[model samples]
Target: MTPDDERFDAKTTVLIETVGHHVQEEETDWFPKVRDALGRKELQEIGARMRDVRATAPHRPEHPGSLRAADALLG
Candidate 1:
């Protein structure tokens, strides 16, 4: 393999491993603490705030070609 190909593979491996570690920590540690600390009413309030924030967030236009590229990758 070329040097560029090897470097790309190494970088991809590191990215995947880092994300997997973060997800594992969140599922096993952070989420349990959050669930234990928040009561049902508080959780609901937080969810409502998140929904409001998302609803009011500004929209940005995507590049015209991005949809096709995303479909090609995700299909």
Candidate 2:
């Protein structure tokens, strides 16, 4: 593959890693706060809304920022 292709791949990897870290932080930090603050019915409704969001979201390639970060880290 071309150097450019390799760079793109590297960036995407870093972006994915960043997202994983964010997910962990959300679960550990924000989720508890949300759970405590919101009622069960409210939380369940929010969960349904989130599921709808995920279901309707369009797919796209990784962001350019992520690609650049990955390339820089790999390089």
Candidate 3:
């Protein structure tokens, strides 16, 4: 494999590990703290605000080759 291939593999491994750690922390610690702090009505309001933001957000253009590359990787 090329040096670029090796670097990409390393970066992908780091990204997966970092995301896994963050997800675990959110599930085990942060989420519980948030649930305890925010009442149901407040949580519902926050969700509504998030939906509004998502509805109004502008679309971002993807790199020309990225979708094909991603499909190839997953295919």
Q: Tell me, by TM-score, which candidate is best.
A: 3
The regions of model 3 sitting more than 4 angstroms off are 1-5, 58-75
Shift of residue 70 alpha carbon in model 1, Å = 26
Measured against the true structure, the TM-scores of the candidates, in listed sequence, are: 0.59, 0.57, 0.68
On the 0 to 100 scale, the lDDT of residue 59 in model 3 is: 56
Candidate 1, 9: how far from true, in Å? 1.9
Model 1 residue 51 lDDT score = 72
| Candidate 3 per-residue C-alpha lDDT over 33-72 given as tens digits, one digit per residue, 9 for 90 to 100 | 9999999999898777667655544455365665554454
lDDT of 2 at 21: 99
Clashes of 2: 2
Which runs of model 1 end up more than 4 angstroms from their true locations? 1-6, 56-75
TM-score of 3: 0.68
Question: Over the stretch 1-75, how does candidate 2's per-residue lDDT look in tens digits?
Answer: 454885888888888999999999999999999999999999888677667655544455365565554454344
> Could you tell me how far off, in angstroms, the CA of residue 62 lies in candidate 1 after the best superposition?
14
Per-residue lDDT over 8-75 for candidate 1, one digit per residue giving the tens place of the 0 to 100 score: 88988888999999999999999899999999898898777657655544454375765654454345
Task: Let me know the TM-score candidate 1 reaches against the reference structure.
Answer: 0.59
Alpha-carbon lDDT, every model: 0.74, 0.74, 0.75
Global local distance difference test of model 3: 0.75
lDDT of 1 at 54: 53
